[model samples]
Target: VSVCAEAFNPDDDDEEDTEPRVVYPKSDDQRARLQEACKDILLFKNLDQEQLYQILDAMFERKVEPTEHVIDQDDDGDNFYVIERGTYDIYVNKDGKPLLVGKYDNHGSFGELALMYNTPRAATIVATTEGALWGLDRGTFRRIIVKNNAKKRRTFETFIESVPLLKSLELSERMKIADVIGERSYQDNELIISQGDQADCFFIVESGEVKIMIKSKTQADQQEKTEVEIARCTKGQYFGELALVTNKPRAASAYAVGDVKCLVMDIQAFERLLGPCMDIMKRNIVNYEEQLVSLFGTSLDLENPGI
Candidate 1:
């Protein structure tokens, strides 16, 4: 199955509410260890506390003796395994010989590729030392992970639609943006962007407000510059596009006004997905400059673009 967001249709209903999830009760000691191990794994990072508990409950432990073959190459895979204890060697059959390619010690995960792609196991896993492994069935994994991912994509799609800067973009382009964008949260008074920093990722306010500040010279004789608030961006409003477009250092700073949440798009995604709309974005700068002139009574120097 394709892992891309678009590959999983949003219309497909999540079975989470209806399906009876399998549970393997664990002792408090076991739960603590699993929680610590899961925290370091990238696969579980996106899941919330409740979803994480569901995963922990679904996992069953398997004890293995030293030199035992845990999984054989080319065998049909049904469950994904995470190491709880001991070491294991990964061998891929190259020609007729078993080639030692990788190893997992103490904490790691495997057997996911087979379940994810619905293919035969690519390698053989042999226990190098006596250990235990946590196993999760494919059904539960897909129901929780795959379905939740689809839900997230749908949420992002809906939110991205409200961003005025992206209104002119085609539907396909907007969907691509939704796939690449990520979320970031900031506390009140937290600095989001610093003046003179190189342009990297731009942002759209998802909640609360962001204050755009610029350093301006009040007079030719002034020894120090004064930071003035230029704009306040609320939900659906975007900033930092100008510097990204001009390939210049940020000419202004931005800070969270209250508890704030933002959707972030890095420079790479901006260049790749929004590249075709460069002319449209450039034209929009005129309106931006006009707004600045009206609001601040002075315009920003385009040679050093601001957010």
Candidate 2:
């Protein structure tokens, strides 16, 4: 059975009614499976059980027979797919022929990038066996997922306002910076930045601590590396400002001292949203440099330790 977006979307007329609205239903096992699937997807990673349920409420079941095209390259995409039970071949065109490019089995998802940005589908996905899937449309994703992300970004914006690097920014400017920031989780002992890696992003500790390490001389060989802990970063502190201006290799490494979460912004977004702050960084660079050297030392890291 196959259906399009218009069929599963909640009726708009029910939203404003005084009566209590009943969300779409799912079985306990179905909800559990959906929640597990949502975790691997960055867009819905932060959703709580209720939010996950809301997504399930908006989604509808789809089934496909062997050799069916779930999505075709170059199509205007408005719906995202989450395969529940299936094996599939994903393809892309090369020299006017569809070339095998990827595969999707149970728990796989596709069409999300297009739904997120309303872009053309990048490849074709065809089922290799009988399959079951769930689909979410652009309207539902925008209404629920987009709004939820917006609210979360607003809270993060408020948090960044406390940083001296951005303290002077107006609420509007801070929000601009906040909107593009992405979230990542690090387990204990995970390296968040590595020494000598080209710096491309800045990070702010949102929760837990990240340890700063500097590379120092070791007994084995002058060329060999040893990490020496120098400082600890707690909530509200940000790093990598030197990279923002110098465009040099990072001088130190940072690792999650324990379970940690951070908000990150890549170089382009950093420059585009906070370009005016370059002047601020320049004036404060010396003081910030002094602080880091006094704390983390000169030789060190770029990437957070490990994946």
Candidate 3:
């Protein structure tokens, strides 16, 4: 089946909702409003006009009432939401107390992580006032974003420019890196990388941003997952090098803060490219180790101990 057909007709066993609904067109006014709404959201703010339109087209319009629960904490997440109007209160149960984690206004979005990772919702999001929302389920969102090669290319180029590791690389090398990598798109609140999972590939942010969650064994009786803003990896910032280099499980979990596009480099491809420059690779690794030791008084174990 064609891509458009497949997008329009998703699941064969799904039952249609009999409730009457208002349909909005892909009109100039709607497009302009969507562009404005995207601007207020950090992730979508930087997307090109065409890309924004494509995303807007994929989403379904939703009108939520005040005090309505959009998503309850611990619920299975299947869709992501983008606020077109009004506000929401995001809360989480902490230490037996309900804590207000965040307040989201127009253009704000959430529920991406659950769709991406198949995890339960981390927080309960309730509409503070009557609102209009754009809902994009996982299937439609991925089909639109990830399968679009042209969009992926643009995202890759934008992301590569922002990565520190590739900043020193030549233009040719950057292009080559972009060519070698594969794209992955996530809805907001999705886990890009899970702590303790086997790391298979390194990632470069093409668009959007992710937050790192670190689990620390604080005391004999306490273990807590602390969310830290290690670095705001936006277009071009690369991560997962530590796992790729050491063959260790991911030390932290990275969650998408908004609609995200990333270029992932397979480990085998990375090693293959570096194979011809073994001597240069060794020198660079050694230099990096020396610099780390000088600054932090500790060195990374890059060499195989058995070898």
Best by lDDT: 1
lDDT values for all models: 0.77, 0.69, 0.61
Worst 10 residues of 2 by lDDT: 298-307
Clashing pairs in 1: none
Q: Which segments of candidate 1 are over 4 A away from where they belong?
A: 1-148, 218-225, 290-303
Error of 3 at 60 (Å): 1.8
Candidate 2 residue-wise lDDT, 73-104, digit = tens: 88877677777888988788999999885566
Which one wins on TM-score?
1
Q: After superposing candidate 3, which stretches have Cα over 4 Å from the reference?
A: 1-28, 40-51, 146-307
Compute each candidate's TM-score over C-alphas.
0.52, 0.50, 0.40
Span of ten consecutive residues with least summed lDDT in model 3 = 298-307
Model 1 scores worst on lDDT over the 10 consecutive residues at 1-10
Q: List model 1 lDDT by residue over 36-71, tens digit each.
A: 766555455567898888999999889999999999
Clashes by residue pair, model 3: 112-187, 112-188, 112-189, 112-190, 113-189, 113-190, 159-236, 162-236, 163-236, 163-237
Q: Write the per-residue lDDT of candidate 3 for residues 122-193, one digit (tens) a residue.
A: 788889999988777666444333334324445566667666666666765565555446667999999888
